[model samples]
Target chain A: MKRFATKLLTAVLLAMFLFVGTQGFAQTINIALANNPISQALNKLAKEKYKAAGVTVNIAVLPENDLRQKLTTEASTGGTSYDMFFIGPYEAASWAKNGWLENLEPYFKAMPAAKLTAYDRPDLIQGMVGSLAVKGQSYALPFYGESSFIMYNKELFAAKGLTMPAEPTWDQIYDLAKKINDPAKGIVGMTMRGAPGWGMSGAPFVTIVNAFGGKFYDMKWNATVDTPEQRAAWAMYKKVLRDAGQPDILSYTYNECIALMQSGKAGIYYDATSIAPALEGAGSKVQGKVGYAMAPHQKMMTNTSWLWNWAMGINPKSSDAKKKATFDFMVWATSKEYAKMSVDLDPTGSSTPPAARTSTYALPAYSKTPYAAMTVKALKAMDFTKPTIDPVPYVGLQYIAIPEFADAGTQMTQFLADYVVDKITLDEAIKKTNDVFNQVAVDGGYRK
Target chain B: MKKKNDWPFILPAIFVVAVMTQVPFLLTVVYSTLRWNLARPDMPIVFSGIDNYLFFLKIPDFTVVPEFYSIVLQTIIVTVVALVICTVIGFLFSILLDHPIPGVNIARTLIMGPFFVMSTVTGVIWKTTILNTTFGWYGVLAKSIGLAPVDLLSYYPLPVIIFLFCWQWIPFFVLIILAGLQGISGELVDSMRIDGLNWWQSTFRVKLPLIMNHIRVAVMLGLVFIVKEFGLILVTTAGGPGTRSYTLPYQVYMQIFSASNVGRAGALATMTVVLTLLAVNFVSKSMKKNNL
Candidate 1:
């Protein structure tokens, strides 16, 4: 009986090893991504497409901040738990500089020339490419990109006899908000993100600062938060949100803004062009009733819009086999064919990824979409390399490009929130923001 | 009875406690002294003693203190105020529920429901269904009554957070204190009644003394958990209108993720641990004195 039991145990152990060995030989890649609508659609598409090719795709969809934290920890430590990271322009440039990302240039060059030509790298929006590149090497592939724009309720505008301009200045926007604001009708004039975070209020607010010709630092990296242009930008944000924004303005973020606009309670919304999908398609109460305009500017007309992308990057420490699989998946996901294919999922082209490929805008399914033309125009017009009208050292339009910007920008966000809510005086806010920025500069050893 | 060789049996537990708790804490202390930053690869991570702590602690001028001090003050105010309310109101609820009233079991279960809820859900539910000005119950009720609904969260952030914290935590205080009240002998209650004590005197002077240990246990547990409350704050006010609602743990988070400064985060974390220990120690001592 003892001998029979021993033999049975041996057979079970052999079966387990066989199962484990088969798993090891199978192709699989793990991707960490932002939980956005585009990515959600991509997640479904890739699971089916990759599974057919005998490659397993495992994806973790995380909120923006949580994704950043997870990726930062994994990349910084050279961990290999994930092969691909869905990061933004801010992370791409900084992580590339840190040598945590796999440089995709060599891989692109090694691709079959026919495949490379089919990829048509130049057809990508130059701003999106620029944001994801360090020096000359591309670090990530843009799945989707957005330049900030103004989306307004056409029904509300027509009702109030307010015609939105082809191009609106900051002052004009404020005036429009005031003219269209109807508290009795339960419709507010504007919706802008007021919740505090570098990515929340900081993204749009920085562009407003740039439009007013305010630089966070000079060429020599001094804290420039107290300049005249800076003050004007500050006052504009405060006055606009306080006078015409939602009742719970201080607690508002882009998510809240999207909900308000989707509910048809907001007159105008100033945020990412990416929000066009949620407004124009799939459970929207205001479909086809929304109008698009360029991002409102002040002193700097050409670069008022902020450029952002949720793109995929390969971790350098990932196995070569895993990297290859990850890149293949990324290419197929971002290809023009994917845009055409997304129509099966959503006929409105709302779930279709936007602004990555120039060809995507020309697709018959996408061309008729309301936001396509304005999106391309805005994408072409934005120059993140020359963010502020005045020359500065940084390369980001909505954010400062230095690694310390996240921390520094977050500090400014708090001060801005306080200033907007009448919690602190303008002078006090300026002094405090300027002081914190200076301290970050000194601590980061950037000023030296 | 002869003592057995218990060291052999207890050694594994001691090893686990040292590895899981003590070693990580020591590592944090060591990391606090290093000048490590995850973002800037050009700058080499090296040992830079005291600089990280000084970053938060140093005040070049008295007129303008660093944000660390303000965040610390905010954390203390929120935690202390919430704990006090939980103790007072929780005791009152316990007294009311202690009587032989019909359907009291249902009332006890309903009161305990909030304590079992996750903090993030509590924040989201309250923000959307209750507090929102345009759509929430508060707004609809206020408007129907012909009054303008203020954004209570924005206008009064600290007070709102305090109230939410108490709403969730007061039941926990009752869970422990009510057990203490039940443990009091029935003969003791009869004697107190026979001594001609009024309701206030009986409940406060007699029953309160009996439950002092339970109150201490509840307060200590509440302080430890409430001091590190982050999720609710993140969902509710997001440590804003400005950083008026930021706490020690929030600063630690900002340092680690936003600043990507492991050393500074470690320093802030160590300081937080020390401050929490000081608070717990103070509460323990006072509660012990009360017991005596």
Candidate 2:
């Protein structure tokens, strides 16, 4: 009996070893991404497309903040858990400078002509490409690009006998909001991000400040947060939000604003154009009732729309084989063919994810979508070279490009929130914000 | 000779403790002394002894904001308030559970449920479902009754966080105090009543004194946990409405991740450790003096 048991155990151990060895031969690439509709579609397509090529794709979709924390920790330690990571333009330059991202220029240059031409390098949006570049070298590929815009309920406008122009000023928006606001009917005049984060409320607020002729800094890196333009912008924003916005404006983020618009509770929603599909998709209460317009401007010196993109970058610490697999997957994921496939898979006009490729925008199926023309126009109208009316050191529309800008912007957002909620006066908020920005610039050696 | 033989049995635990506790702490101290800013990699790291510490401690003459001092005060207030509330409420619940009543076992389990729920979930449920101005029960109920819905978290972020911490920790105190109550001899309670003491007097004079040690242990544990609270603030308010709810841990997190200043973060972390150690020491010394 002992001999028989020993033989059986040996057979089981050998079987397990063979099973594990066979599993190792199949290539698998892991991706870390934020939880969003575009990522969800890409994860599904990656599995279906890569399975036949003897490759497996695994995706870990996490909340926005959680994904940021995970990626930051991984980059700091040079961990190899994720071969590819989704990064926003705000962190791309910093990540590249820190040697956390693999430069993709070499891979793009080495690609075969057939694949290169098929990919159509010139078709990618210029601003999107520029945002993902470091020192003229591309470090990431744009999966989808977006800029902010205003989505208003046409039915509400008609009912209230209000007319919304194709290009409205900030004053016009405020006037419309006041006219249409009806708390007793559960209709909010406007929905905007008020959550306290650099990327949340700060993004829209910066755009507003720019339209008000305010610049974050002068060429000498002297903080201009205390300028008259900025103070006027803050005052206007607070008045509009207090008199026309929903209650608890301080707690409302993009998600809350989206919910408010989709449920027909909001008359105007100013946020990323990426929310267009979700708002117009099936089962939405306000589907087919929404009208689009450019982001509101004040002085018309600079457009108020903010440019942002969700892009993918290869991990610098990943093994060569994993990097190759990751690049291959990324190329296919962001290609025009994949964009068509995404639309085909869903077939709903609403499933068409915003494409970065010019060719994809020209597709008949995509153009027929409700907000496609407006989105493409906004994308073209984005001016990254001159994000503000006055000359400044930063290149971003919604944020300053330097890494220290995150902390500075977050601090300013807090003071802005205090001003909005009546916790502090406008002068106090402006002084505190200027102090924080000046301190950051000095500490970073950006100013004498 | 026996002691020499016992070294093998104790060496593994000592090694684990050193690796788990001492090594990281030593690394934090070392890192705190360097000029390490991840954002400015062009600048090389150098020895910068005590500069990071002074950066946090220094008060600017131009402004009276007292940023660091405010965070420290907020941390102390939250910890003390949460400790007092949890201990008092927990003691009351423990007395009620000590009696032999029908369905008491299930009732105890129900009361202890919040302790088992994760802190992140607690923050989310409270922020989104309970306290949110729109789509939340508070909002819906307020609107239904013709009243303006109040955003509790926006107006009272720190107090709401304190309530959440107390809610989560009261169960812990209840469980520990209940165990202490069970260990006490029932004859003492009967003897107190036989001496013409009322129920309330008996609880204060006898049961309270008997369970004072358990309460102290609970308070000490609560203080340690409260001082390290990050997820509750991170998920709910994110130390916001202009840093009104910024705690020490959240401040350290902002320094490292948001600011990308590793040296400053390390300095803040070391300070936090020292503060926690001092608090623990004070509490333990007081407990010894009281002989509870």
Candidate 3:
């Protein structure tokens, strides 16, 4: 028994020694990122450079919903499983307020003078910076920023004898869609995301609701989804999709819209402006045949577009050493050097991250791209602080700015989808959704 | 007497099982009694008694039923419908394939292909390649016939999902039932034929009784698995068209991951387990009664 006890003690001590020895040799950080085109490119571009920095990176690329769930679980549990993660404005602001994210402002101030100069913290887009900040404390670094816009096939418009206005109204766009729709030729007049999720159909749909002067809530947290203005927005959304949208409109997401535009099957596409590069670059059948326009409006004219970004944030639960290593990697990944590397790596210029930095737009190569100016213009034209014409309890252009909004808003989209598909009456959809949302608000102690 | 000393050998497994299942379950029951919303970091997590359970149980209006009941009903309907179709069609297919024919093994293997495919893959194939109104074969075929194809995934999501579940699971039923059919003695078959028993009588009266045990086992396994299916629903309908096809497990997932209400999720999970156990017990009892 004494021999066995000694042997077990020695084995445990040896295991501890090996663990400490390996951890001391080099720092390793785990980063959770959403699986998107730009992040895929980043994963490929940062391979050798991350290893060369004397730190190993373990990245988990998951679908957008899965990424959000995993990162939220880790942070809420105060687990140190992830050292860094990719987050959007919704998560950045909420997590920072929860005291879950490492304040990157202090990290920025602590950088060596010369290194800070090279990092050019000021050159990062202020709009993105402000969105990811809470009470003037920065929570994340913008990797890429985007706003919404309209991308139309100029050839289709010309053939139909219709010219798109630079800033069109929703009514005008609907009329044009009616004119341009040609199902016989397998062409639809417009394409938008219709998949049921908060980020899927809800993004574009919320902006439409904003343009139509509808708010999800009143100043005192009363649900206003069944209001006249909101009903009008829903009617318009349903009318266009039913008349001129894809045959499988309910199944279409942004990827499908992109593919439809590239195939020249869509007359108009309204989605993220960042996808313009993909529509105009090599391998696109509609290259040079697409035209850009601002997001459409009906009542509220200004700030009709959305502001969105996927930023990098540090986990507050990480040890100081891992946090430092993670901050360094975040710096490198968002640096000008990485931007140039990405641009050079992608010949088509479609997959390179963009709109995060002022200097990126100043690059001679990027400015020459036809859609770069429009992308920047759209990004600056929206404000998330004031989303609707009427006073509301939330702040977000394309989403509601509460942690509970992701759940409630997604539940609301199911009713919208059913309404869009004529599965339920408009009144029934409205009553069910409002009930669900109001119940969530009351349960979460958000409403009085 | 040396056998009494064997506890040391069994204690590790008991410990592992306790840690893996019972401990977590106990924690879940404790959590279900609290008011914990992970999303609302501002709210204090405190003991709230049975408030979480009551939240799901309370229905404000009979006309407007709560989602929990609807989800449970949908789960039952989907499981029961899918099992019936799979068993009926699978038994017929097994009877046909049980005949002596060349390349019978090939046919059986081909039928088993979908059962081997991942559920997510099956959903993707059905959604994108078959049911998609614009990009799929259904669209082309419908258009060729001069008729517009309605979006089956959105309009008739429940039926489409039930059909796909049957397509994928029927093969598993066939495998087991066919084994039972092949096990019947050749003397019995010769005796049935000599007694002028028709094919229908032999099949429905004799063969089915012999295979009730196999069918019961298949239904039990199917119920256990299909009730917990998440990926297929996610990849295809996503529990949408106003949660018309949502199951209890899907609701638990939404409560935990989407709502970030750990307490509520625990409540939903406990109810789901209870409902599942009740279903399994009822099935086992009914099957035993039928056997008797």
Candidate 4:
């Protein structure tokens, strides 16, 4: 009986130790992310670096639309499946307004001064910080900030005897594209997103509209989609895409455009500045031959480039402990320390996160990199406070920061796509685009 | 006048069915009567009394791309075209498979292959591998032949979607019609042949008449399934080149998930249920009249 009792006690003790050890060793936090290069890089670092720091990070990377839908569904029900998620500026305000995002200001304040200084809150890009905040309260921390710009092949320009200005106009870009286009040689001169969704065509197209002096809505919220500026922008976009764009451009999104540029097939790619890392990465064919320029201008009353940031927002429904863990991971992942560590891991600066912080950008190694320098210049030039030439009742450049705008923007993209392919006439496309905007305006109570 | 105690045995099944099917439907009906926007929590939910329904049904100006009526018409047209193509092709394939040709088993497997593929995979394969303008097989073939590759999805979005649906579901119809063909005895076919009927006459007058019930079943099943075809359309073209291919189900999905207008989505769902019920009822009545 004594021996049996001792054996039982030993078994119970072992079980308790195992349970406590597991609990202490592996506290997991789930992160929902969009499947972008930045997110993938973060996931790699989390596994390699943060796993040893006592928290197991589980990341679910989904496509952009799928991630949006999943986060929206979870937010609607106040679900706790995800402890944190990546959100765009367009969704930050709406999600914050809906009480789905945790206010990150308090968390930042609660951190020790030493830690705060290390994180360097003020070092963050002002435009990015402003865009990720709602009513002056930060709700998310930007993982990487991006603005639109034109990336071209310097070698291609030299071969074709073409001169691209540092700040080229849309007409100039179009002419360059036509000159360099060699369909017989299987090279596309220009590549842009033509996929049907709003995030695909609508993103770049909105910047075009802004550069042409088109407004989504007037101060009174009347849809201005039928304006002469919008028509001109659409006409230019359609003609250029048809004449110089890659074949089956309708299926091309950002990834496809990047692939075309990297494979030395495209002469010029006008897209997000964040693609710099991929374009200059080790595997890139045009790494040494790529050139950066400002986004093309038309009227140039306002900058044509858009302001976008992929930021991490904590779920409001998470427990305080989970929130703390999430914030810790977020700060660490976005900190200068993390950026330095990333650069050390890959000395070529390809793995370095887009410098959200001024200090990170000031790093001697990062500042000297061509892509990094160009990206910082573009980021500094963006004015999120006034993204368009005309005053509109929204705060977004690529997208209007309203929930209704998601639907309206997607519908308008469909119309623009059809118009580009000659599936519908320009007039019909404009009418349909205006109708969608008007309906959204009235239904959202922005107009009567 | 008999009081059957079978209720006791079936009560659990009835309860399960009610819980599985009726509760969400009832919730949807309740939700349809309220004004609920998930994005606008400041706007309190209140009784709106068919406002959402009316809003959805309201006709836009003809200039608009997706007038509500146009979506409905397009949905119907796609469903009909898909059904006709699936039924005819499936029946012919079923007849072909019944023959004792060499390598017939392998051919049968190949014919049944698409049915096992998921809808999303079907859409992706068609969009990326088959129909893509640049890198797809169609483009490669077109280019190799020294012709400009056609952007089939952009130019003919609806027809291409219909083709995808038909491709995926035809195998299902084939299996059904093939099973129905097996039920007709060899003796009956022999008698029809001995009765001086030509091959075409026997097929039209005897075999087709016999399998009319199977054809009806296939059509009804296709109608029921095609109305909920969201994945294929969502993955390819996204109901576009301008709402030329937008269906009612895709519209409802956009209203709920994309637009966050749950009340409007609910209203659309209620209408879809009603229409589907009416269609099922009509199909059943026709089957009864034919004594199948």
Tens digit of lDDT per residue, candidate 3, span A1-448? 9999999999999999998988787877998777666787778777755554558888878777778878888888898889997899999988998999999888988899999999998888998989998888889999988899999999999997899999999999999988899988889999998887788788888899999998888877778888998888888889999999988877887778888889998999988887888887778999888899999988999788888999999999898988999999899988987887767766456767788888877766677777887887888788888888877878889998889888888887888898998878888888887787787668767787
lDDT, candidate 1, residue B249?
A: 90
Show the lowest summed lDDT stretch of 10 residues, model 3 chain A: A45-54
Per-residue lDDT for B1-292 in model 3, tens only? 4786778998999999999999998899999998999988898999999999998998888987677888888999999999889888998999998998999999999999999999999999989888887778998899999998988888888898899899889999999889989998999999999999999999989888988888888889988888888889888988877688788888898889888999999998999889999999998898898782
Which of 1 and 4 is ahead in DockQ?
1
Residue-level lDDT of model 1, residues B63-179, one tens digit each, is: 875788988999999999999999999999999888779999999999999999999999999998999998899999988888878998888899999999999999999999999
Q: lDDT of each model, Cα atoms only?
A: 0.88, 0.85, 0.87, 0.84
Candidate with best TM-score: 2
Docking class of 2: medium
**DockQ (C-alpha) of model 1?**
0.65
Ranking by DockQ: 1, 2, 3, 4
Give lDDT for model 3.
Answer: 0.87
* Cα TM-score per model: 0.94, 0.95, 0.93, 0.93
Over the stretch A269-383, how does candidate 4's per-residue lDDT look in tens digits?
Answer: 9898888778887788998788999998898544679888889999989887788889999998889898888777766567776847777777777777778777877887877
* Model 2 per-residue lDDT at A21: 93
Candidate 2 CA-lDDT value: 0.85
| Pick by lDDT: 1 or 2, better one | 1
CAPRI-style quality class for the chain A–B interface of candidate 4: medium
How does candidate 2 fare on TM-score?
0.95
* Chain B TM, per prediction: 0.95, 0.95, 0.95, 0.93
